[model samples]
Target: MIKKSMLVEKITRRTIGFVLTMLILSIGVFYLSRLAPGDPLQSFYGDAIESMSTEELDAARIRLGLDSPVYVQYVKWISNAFQGDFGLSLKYKMPAMAVITPLIGNTLILGGIAYILVFALATLLALFCAMHEDTLIDRIICKVGTAAYYIPPFWLGVVLVLIFSVNLGLLPSSGAYSVGKSDDILNRIQHMILPLVVMILSHLWYYAYMIRNKLLDEIRKDYVLLAKAKGCTKTEIVLKHCFRNVAPTIVNIMAISIPHVLSGTYIAEAVFNYPGIGALSVQSAKYHDYNLLMLTVLITGVLVIASSIIAQSVNEVIDPRIKLMEESP
Candidate 1:
């Protein structure tokens, strides 16, 4: 009963912290959007408005409600955003959601597949390295993973494009799928191959290294030694004992990787012209489209904070030491 009450209290506190972080991040995003130079409306108008007088510009500003005070504008934007409205995109001249939702779908498709693939491969590779620690296989895996880790995704995408698309004609150089092609599973999978490969190559290394190090650390612990002394098989010791003990650390790394996944995909999206959230964000930022840019960032911020909170909570679950420490006082 005491543990249950404590858990509830901890959850409540974490919820409050998450909400506070979200509020601060939202305010920062709001203010930074205001501080950026150039008008979003101007991106819509461009130099085509050179002949327009100040009166015309002011009139246009009023029409867009850009003439309002910053605070009033923010309040209105926030209120509308909460109701599933993010205003019209100056670039697309459509509802912001119309422009963003499809991009988000593309991004999730890419990122979700990449994250799962990279994580699974990294886990296996890291386990292999851990099992063969100090062997030739371990050394080779370490060197290769490290090398791949240092290679940027964009450069890797270019190389893949040259080899697979240009030379062998095995893959398309750009586009999520062939234009006007139906959204068939096979077509989507074919499009995913390049970006997925790029992602796995660019991302798997770090996780491999981290997991390998974690496994090595776990193997050295006194509990692991005791398990070995108790006649546990090698596989049992490694999987049931070591992996379980290191689960929290691995999960923490994954949580940290969430934000990086978003940032990393930007280069991949740009290289392949994948039309994901990363590409949309890049376009929005370049064009100074406040609505889309701010909305994207706001979503990213929420995800980051929420992921962190979740990771912390999960970590506590995997490692009772965290709960004990929290309960200490």
Candidate 2:
């Protein structure tokens, strides 16, 4: 009962924190959108804002509600954004949702696949190395993981493109699909293979090494020794004792990695020309599409902050030590 109550308190705190974070970020987004030096009209319609007729200019401002006071504009925007409307894109000349929807879908697909693969493979490999600490296999895995982790992501992407797409010609060099004409699972996977591999290879090593180190340290705890003394099997001790204990750390690492992985996808997207949010974000930055850039940043920031809060709440729940430490006299 006490544990349930504590868990409820933790979830309530995290939920409140997430709402506060999104509110703050939305305000920041609104203010930052107004701060862009060049007008979106100039950037989108060519730098002839003064030459544009009153009708044309008013039409443009009206389209974006830019004619309103900043606070009023922000209030309306917050209302619409809550309803999943981000207004029209100045550059794309379509609803911002229209321009962003497919790209967001692509990003979620790629990011989700890579994150699951990285985390699962990293956890398994780390467990193996931790179990075999100080052995030849451990040394080799550690060295290789360290080396892979330190290499630049773009460099890895390039090398992957060169080998799989260029040299082998086995996969599409740059695209989310092969000209978008088929729904065959095999064809879709073939198109997905290169970018997915690039993402996994670029990220898996660092997480593997971190988890391995943490699990190794955790395996030496007195509780683990006591579990072993009770005649628990090796798998039981590692799985139930060590893995459960380290799960919170893994969650924390994943929460921190979410933002980075989101940003880092841009390199892979740029290399492969995949139609994901990362590529879209880069285009927005280059073209100075303040609205699109702000929207992307705002959304990504909310997800990252929410994940962080969730991780913290999970930490508080799983590790009663934290609550106790905080409550110490």
Candidate 3:
């Protein structure tokens, strides 16, 4: 009964946290976007804004609800948002959510694949380096990974385009799909390759290095000492004891990595011209598309916050001590 109560309390706290985060994110993005130097009228009315008289401009402002005070605007927005109405995209001239519905999938595809591959490869790379220790291979990996991690993702992306897309003519350089092949799975994969290369190369080593260090730290613990005194080999202790205990730390790393990997994913989209939320965000910001921009930022914020919560839950499962500690008197 106590366990159930603790579980309920945890869920309640997490749920409240998620709601508050979205509220703060929405307010920040909304206020900042409005305060930024730009005529949102230009976004909605395009060149028509240039020709409008004062009366017409005021009418336009009134029509779009931009004539109100900032707080009043926010209140209206938040109230409508709760009812599943996010308003029309000023630039796109459609419901903001409608504009996002299609493009989000591409981002998910790129981000999901990159997220899985990065963690999986990082773990394997960490394990290899951990097992190798101070060998020549380990030193080489450390140097190469550090260098790769430091290279700006956009510049690396450009170079990849020059090599494989321009010089060798091997891969599609931009866009999520070739013209008239939206549903072609193989073609979609081809488009994803270069962006994936950028995303993975940018992030692969950062997590790997951290995990490698964590594994090494775990290897030095008292339990590992006990295992060693029991005649366990280095490999046996690392695989059986060290790595097992480090699973919670690895989960934590993965949780915090959402934002890191997401930034890389956005960079990949912008560089590759992928028709994902990243590219859309760039467009929205450039055009001062207020509704579209807010929705996009909120979506991104939710992913990051939710990942942390999910990681906490996973850690509770992997190491029950986490739950007991949090729930203790």
TM per candidate? 0.93, 0.83, 0.97
Q: Residues 1-329, candidate 2: write the lDDT tens digits.
A: 97698768767776797788888887886786677676767656876777889999999878767888888988887888889878767778777677887788778777878888889999999989888889998999888877877887777778877888789988777777776555566776777787777777778888888998898788888988888889997678788889888988899899899977776677778878888888887777666665677677776887688778777767878887867875465
lDDT tens readout by residue for model 3, 4-104? 88778879989998999899999999999988898988999999888899999999999999999999999999999999999889998999999999999
Model 3 Cα shift for residue 95 (angstroms) = 0.9
lDDT for model 2, please.
0.79
Best by TM-score: 3
Q: lDDT, candidate 2, residue 12?
A: 79
C-alpha root-mean-square deviation, each candidate: 2.0, 3.5, 1.1
With candidate 2 superimposed using the best TM-score fit, by how many Å does residue 128's alpha carbon deviate from the native? 1.1
The lDDT for every candidate, in the order shown, is 0.84, 0.79, 0.93
Error of 2 at 217 (Å): 1.4
Choose 1 or 2, whichever is better by TM-score.
1
